[model samples]
Target: MKNKIEISDLQVHYRDTSALNKVSFDVHENEILGIIGPAQSGKTTLLKVINRTLEFVPEASMDGTVKLDGVDISTMGDIYGLRRRIGMVLPLPVGLPLSIYDNVAFAPRAAGLRSKSQLDELVERCLQQAALWDEVKDRLSTLGTKLSGGQQQRLTIARALSHQPEVLCLDEFSIAIDPVTTMRIEEVLKTLQKEMTILLVTNLVQQAKRLATRTAFFLNGDLIEIDSTDVIFSDTPAQQATYDYINGTFG
Candidate 1:
């Protein structure tokens, strides 16, 4: 399979603390690459670096390289252009104060898409992709923040999809939503994988086993192991530590 994103000797430092240590991995195109680890294992840090959002962190610095589609992201002239190719959904749902329609429309408009018909089609398509259209189609003008937590979470996914990113990064996206909604979104992700590569970071090992083509285990900022989901969840993993973590013996 072709690689959509590649990381080599990647390191992230925040002040005196190291957040990611020499992490290296490849995200295959059109595949869902799951990242699983305990808290503070640098999973989120990895996503931020991939999307270049880590630059906003105070005292944060990085070494090594991250490449998207064979192009070094660090060498990109337009940060916004780079970000537009990667969509990110966070653990917590963050809805803009704008109406649901406007929230999903925000990205395209910012990209200079002005045709009302185009915006309408984009909004519906994204919302549908997010599994949110049926719930919000009648309330397009309503404030996005007014929706339920689960609805808002799905809304965030729709907003992320508005840019039609080549890569989608989801960091513990189901953490705050109810199980039913989480499952629904999981189904959406399975479908979306046909359209874009996905980077999924979740503490839930079972979720990774269910959705990921490949899984990577992280421990104390280190990438312990990365392999096919079958191998990662096998009776004996490539690393004893990975086996322990997956077996509920340790994180």
Candidate 2:
């Protein structure tokens, strides 16, 4: 498989604290890379760093490299274009005041797509991909915030996909959802793996097992284990922290 994203000696610092310490890994094209860790373990920060959102944080600095498609992100002249190629789904569902259809169309418009039919095509494609069109089919004009929590999340996912990103960053996308809704989101994700590389930060252990092609375990802002999901779960040796956490010794 082609390398969709790569981290080489990656590190992030906030004042005296190291948020990510020399993290290194590669996400294959169209594969799922699950990031598992306890709260404040830098899981989210790592994603932000990769997506270049960390630059907005006060006193945040990073070292080494994050590459997408063999191109170092720091060297990319088009940060906006780079971001469009890497979509991010936040932990909380962020809905615009606009209607559901408009929310999904936002990115397309920002990307300079103006033809009504073109935007309509993207809207349908993204909503269907998010498993939301069927639910919102009759009410595309309704406010996205009016949907149930799960549906709102799916709407957010649809909004992220509007850019046709090569890589999708999922920041605990299912954390606020119920079990059944989480399952539906998982189904949508499974379908997504056919075209997009997913980098997921999740607290749910079972989620990684169910959807990840590979997994990375982080503790104290350091990447301790990264391997094929089968090996990481069943065969490869894990760090003591990962072992203890996975075995329920500690969170």
Please, what is the TM-score per model? 0.98, 0.95
User: By TM-score, how accurate is candidate 2?
Assistant: 0.95
Query: Each candidate's root-mean-square deviation in Å?
Result: 0.9, 1.4
Clashing pairs in 1: none
Error of 1 at 223 (Å): 0.3
Winning model by TM-score: 1
Q: Give all candidates' CA lDDT scores.
A: 0.93, 0.87
**lDDT of candidate 1 over 1-251, digit per residue (tens):** 89999999999999999999998888899999999999989999999998899999989999999999999999999999999999999999999999999999999999999999999999999999888899888889999999998889899999999999999999999987888878888998999999999999999999999999999999999999999999999998889999998899976
In model 2, which regions exceed 4 Å deviation? none
In candidate 2, how many Å is residue 217 off? 0.1
Q: Which stretches of candidate 1 lie above 4 Å from their native place?
A: none
Top lDDT: which candidate number? 1
